[model samples]
Target chain A: MSFFNALLEHTFLQHALFGGLLASLACGVIGSFVVVRRIGYMAGGIAHAILGGMGIAYFLGQQPMSGALISALIAAVIISRVSRVSKHGHHQEDTIISALWAVGMSIGIIFIAKTPGYNVDLMSYLFGNVLMISANDLLLIGLLDGGVLLFTLIYFKQLLALCYDPEFAGLRGIRIEWLNTLLLCMVAITVVILIQIVGLILVIAMLTLPAATARLHATTMLGMMILATALGMMITSGGLLISYNYDLPTGATTALSSGILYLVAALIPQRRHAVK
Target chain B: MPALITLKDVSFSYDDRPILDHVNLTINEHDFLGIVGPNGGGKSTLLKLILGLLTPSTGEISVFGKHPNQVRTRLGYVPQFATFDSAFPITVLDTVLQGRLGKTRSLLGYNKHDHAIAQRAMAETDVESLQKRAMTALSGGQRQRVLIARALACEPEILLLDEPTANIDPHHGESIYELLHRLHERITMILISHDVGFVSRSVTRVACLNRTLVCHATSPVDSDSINHLYSNPVSVIHHDTRLSLEDNL
Candidate 1:
């Protein structure tokens, strides 16, 4: 059945679409900061590290997504601490991020290996099956989305200062280190929401690609976020239709579409100055 | 002039490598002080210390009769223009308004008074016309001016600049110095510069740093003293005329 026809008939399709919308809210908001601050690599590392959480959760016979959430938040805290310590030292931040990334995936694989049953569902977590998004997953995504939006709204100015120039923010008595850690934690939560739709491997794409595309034309952070969110919704819907039509993987199709859209946006000649 | 900032035997090091050693300096109110030094001579590090961005390994530094961090909001800082990411999406007005961050009390964002202050700062720096423009659309000189405006929006008692004219052309550099000179009438200013000639010509006081510091009144500064501090033959320009240290001596 065509995606449009199935969308009318199937509750799962509706849940998947709603999940995409909720995920995009967090993606557009947090992803804007992540892209502007140039922390996408760190965010990517956090996403990859989530597999370790899933692995441990499965080993403990718990919900894998819950494990992913716990793992993401812990990874964020650890990454922020590592970044702070290594910022002025010989030990580079990216080196540590890469270590965590690899270790997390490796641990996940090991745990899945030890699980008694044939853990065929592990594939869905790695490369997400959006069509499998249950109503419970939608509720979780919604709650996370609300938290991300509220936090971003309250601390928008401080976050802007931090992302633009952290030293200046520190001088302003902004408590930049604590704010940075909180920002990372927010990114971690956003990562979990994104993992539901795009899975761990392709999560960074959904997190960054729309924001990157919006950056080409946005004059302000708020504009970039709003534009990125709208673009994200369109991309998700488009990817879903195309995947259903061609019987392709939904997560990969969404990631591929996001990449193509970003490239296309880059190629288009944009106005040099955004409207005031 | 009353002493506004005082550093007592301040020593700082990075990983046991001494960047600054036993440096003592006092800055007075309404003073335009310039700090000039060789590369890696801890000039920038000193400003960071004063801004409370870095703690000293030893010694006491105080601003406004208190710790630097306690008086941080009262002190403005203009970072090197080269260090900025121009491609970052922000408006000139928004960038300047960041100066009011420390004073902003509400979570709803900048207030009417904040906007008024930012606008006044942009006007003082002659960047009011460019307030609506994207930061990326600005030239190097325009960007420097915008940064100055941002610092000025803080309504600071003392403004600290780290190489305000490092990357801009000579013409823009001169204008920036001119703006700083004008601002000196009301605001105490401390700036680090590599251009010894401009420092000597513009500032009321000059401090030459090279693992140690030598303070000199502007009129009494000479190339021989600077060359001795640098431990290298350096050329010092005065009023567009290039003079080798030996010739000036």
Candidate 2:
């Protein structure tokens, strides 16, 4: 009762709650695909790579979020393009992804270094500061959530086909490359939206773990999404509660809570249809 | 009936290493073709070419009088069953519904009509009862049948199956072929396999693909052609029966 009272007393706290739920919504829907496609590393690469975009945005005197979003989309295209070019070229794709991962961080570091009078909010970028989440962040999260929901509602089947059987989807004349590019872009967008809650470093964990934990119990993709969203909300809100009461960092505490929840879920024996 | 698929001097190479070399072939309506070749003999590669997963390096291919990709919706595909991720979180029904990918335009969603086709396909494959089961929980044979159901859901004109039983047990493999034989009359099927005896028995035509094509053009493919396909004539011991498998020289 008092927790709700305290949460309602502050607008920033309310924004954090709203933003966290929206982030959960996006993560649950998109993260399900990310887990099934086994694109965790690539998604992580994109999340980290978005920092380069953020850094560049900072250097270029542009709004950092839009710049980050654009660079992440571009990075998504680059990742896909690189993978496509090397599909049969005897090149290991993991190496390419790793290269991009390093390149993104390196570029971000170099740009941050060159940005004169740069305020060091690297902590927020790396770990996150959900307590400081603003109304603008909430609106951005809401809009992104809308787009993601609309996309899933309209193209759920297409996304399912793409993830389950790419070749079959291709043979169905689905224009797999474009759909794939769109999927990667969504991953990038989801990362952009989530950076405030879990930061770039821990983004993949929240994106993947909730879905992965849900997958053990879910018989269908929709079921997985629903369960994951609920779990994400619980973890996020619970993390927020702990942070508020214990004077901890909101995002890290929330992320740590999710990690603990995953362990607990894992420890729970006899989860129906659990993967071996 | 017009040619359903045509490949003209098609060749594919992986980084300068040839997989298919100067291959030319044509398949017509209602043709049940069994493409048999050794490992790395371009049998799967040929199917990929037709599926438009890879463009031929030096030749042209067409499906239903159009570019392979353009007519992909009319052609059903069953990729190697082993490639499926068992832990993927998809229901059998959801997997089958994916076959309706071509029918549902954006915003239209899957109408009841689409579900009807998927249900019929599931019934045809005798997997209707398992519709709600997760994909990973099914047995190998059940999974393969579900895959066929998915392919059939598209109502495709030509069905291409790539090694449907490569990882299946011998008993289950025959049953899988039996299912294919049942659907043979309706859909023109092209099956890629290394099982000469099975191909010889099941298909209307047997094409030997080893960097080139020499089709038997008849059922019950003769031992002579089998011997030619495999330069070194050999036989297999299958369930106490002597099954011949000739290796390409």
Candidate 3:
């Protein structure tokens, strides 16, 4: 109880909590679509692809998230369009995504190496530091989360149609191409907001795992979204508490917690006989 | 009567290989058209073109005197069961509700009327009991019924189905056809099936495709005519065993 009280009193911890909640909500909602669409690899590719923008921002002496956001948005568009046109199969799509991921990571590494007196705390960027979250970051996260939630709610029918049956959706007057592009952009924005808490390495897991777990239990799309958000919050808050007490990397711990939750859900006895 | 849908000298190809060539067709309102063909004969592609899911390489196609996409609100489609991954986490009700997506005003969300329509569609298809069930849990026939309900929820003037009865038991398949038979009174239907006898019985007309349009005519078609239309020599016994056009009709 004392530790809980102490943790709550810290201003940075407060920001971290708020940030985590907002980010997790975004991840949980959009992540459902990502998992259903089988775009897990694309989400990872977009996350790593943002590294190029981070490198560019560092070179330009600007905030990294802005660069990350722009680069990620561009990469998301390019990757989605490429994946759509390639037509070979899932294997080819995975190869292209992997190539883009490698190139983006290399760009960030090279730029970071060239900078002088660049002895920054890289661990904070990689593993997340709850103690370093700022008010501005929290505000940005809140607004972006609101935007994503609004867009998702407004376009829920269209998105559901696209996710379930793209060809039929097109037949029903849904603009599948535009909807696909919009979804990719939404994912890019999600990755940008998430980078401050989970970082690039773990953001994909944060986005996908909670949704996948929730799907095992949910009967409706809306139910899946709510359950996934709840699961994400649990992982984020519980992981933060564990990291604080044990002095471990916050992002890795949070992601691992979500992974464990997924495994547990998978193990739960399902009503197999009910299935027709 | 003026045709509700017309295709004028349509041709299509994928990567320089001709799939549909110089074809023309017409469908009247309330007509039930069955498209039959061998594998890779572009039967599905023809349906796609009609639905505006694919663009014709040459010629023009129109639905109700407008482009297919422009009149999409009046169109409902049920694709092949194999085209969908039933493992998706969605309820029967929600899946059915998606048929009304185009009618809803953007950003306003679904209204009471939409739910009512979806419910009515489910009731009509006899899948109302499965409304709350996870789509993955349903049998193939049940899933197909839910899909049909989803398409019907659109209140379309035309309903398109691709091999809707492929994987279901014969009883369920016949029941599905019975349901569609009732539905044909108010809406135009285009169905694709390889089961020649079944389609010949259920449909008002039959269009045979073999890399191109072979023949299309009103049913009670002669079995001998259809047998000769197939390019590869198939034993008459095979056709007779699988399909009995006279008995089915």
Candidate 4:
């Protein structure tokens, strides 16, 4: 009990709480779209693809987040554009995304090998070190959260149309293509923010799982968003406490906990009907 | 009256294979035009072309004296039943509200008026009872009604439907036709179907297609004309064992 009290009193722990809350909010909102569009795999692909940016930034002796953002954005743009023209459609998008993921990890591995005296803490980036989060990182997260919330509010109608029926949306002048691009951009931004805490390997789990879990219980889009946000907050905060007590990795714990929650939700019995 | 929609020398091909060939069509206001054809005769493709979902390869298409895309907001489309995934998490009311997206501003969320319009549309389609229910939980007939409600929420000048009653029960199918008949007085409609009798009875005009348009005009159509339009030998099968037995004897 004393140890828990000490941990709570720590400033680093406070920063972690604040950052996790912000990150969770961003993921929960943006994740609703990702799950509805069935782009969970694409999100995973983009998250992993950020490693290439991390490698280049490390080689240049700069902040890895900068490189991760730039590289992830570039990968996102390429994936979105290529997915549009590819003969196999979304399958081709997944193929390219997986290839980018492999390339990114390989580049990061090589850069780590070349760098002399690996003094920088790489694990902090991988599993998240919320204690080390600065004011600038917090501000960046706040801005991203605000942007995502605003975008969701502004384009609520159009996004709903795009999600439900693209064909009808096109006929009704919803600008399906532009909305698709905008959604992909939002996913990229969300992934970049999450990579700070969950790392590339596990960030998609945070994005996809909570919304999916919420979907099992909620009948409406708004309900799903609310449930997802609530679930995400629980996972982040609970995982933080567990990590502090057991000295486990926060990202892995949070992701695993969320995944379990999804399974539990799925097993709960209320109504089962074939999808229309 | 000048045609409300016109397609002049319109053609569409996917890869090297042509789906619609040099199709010419004109639809006037308040006209309920039913397009019928074989399984792969491009009935759905033609609707897509008119709705601006697919661009024409060779010619000009106009809706209300403007290009289809330019006037897209004036048109409503209810696509084939297979196009939507019901597993998507959304309520019936929310799905219907999507029809108002074209009229709503991009940044502003749906207002009270939008909600009211969506509710009215659902009521018109007889789906208001299922407003709060999950879409996937509805029956096939109910789902179709919700989709119609969504299309109607757009308040369009023209409504385009691709196989609106394709998978529903006969009762539901009749109800759909009845609904369309009632709505025909207000909005122009283009219905695509494979059932000849259904279209011929309900539509003001009938269009028969086979890889290309064979005929399109006001209906109460003749059987011979439809036979010639389809280019298939019309056969009547009488299930009689007596005829065969007598022939053998």
Best by lDDT: 1
After TM-score superposition, the amount by which residue A233's alpha carbon in candidate 3 deviates from its true location, in angstroms, is 1.2
Cα-based TM-score, every candidate: 0.95, 0.91, 0.92, 0.91
Worst 10 residues of 2 chain B by lDDT: B240-249
Model 1 chain A lowest lDDT segment of ten = A267-276
Error of 2 at A231 (Å): 0.7
Collision pairs in model 2? B230-B247, B231-B248, B235-B244, B236-B243
Proportion of native contacts present in model 1: 0.69
Give lDDT tens digits, candidate 3, residues A32-63.
99989988889889999888888878878889
What tens digits encode model 1's per-residue C-alpha lDDT throughout B173-216? Answer: 99988999899999999989988777766788988898899898
Q: What is the full ranking by DockQ, best candidate first?
A: 3, 4, 2, 1
| DockQ of each candidate relative to the true complex | 0.53, 0.55, 0.64, 0.58
Q: What residue pairs are clashing in model 1?
A: none
What is the number of backbone collisions in each predicted candidate, taken in the order shown? 0, 4, 0, 1
- Candidates sorted on lDDT, descending: 1, 2, 3, 4
Residue-level lDDT for A209 in candidate 3: 96
Error of 4 at A236 (Å): 1.5
Docking class of 2: medium
Once fitted onto the true fold, the runs of candidate 3 whose alpha carbons sit more than 4 angstroms away are: A87-92, A272-274, B235-249
Off by over 4 Å in 2: A59-62, A88-92, A110-118, A270-276, B105-108, B222-224, B236-249
Q: What is candidate 4's lDDT per residue for B103-132, written digit by digit as tens?
A: 865347677888889999999999999898
Angstrom error at residue B175, model 3: 0.7
Model 4 interface CAPRI class: medium
Q: For model 2, what is the C-alpha lDDT against the true structure?
A: 0.85
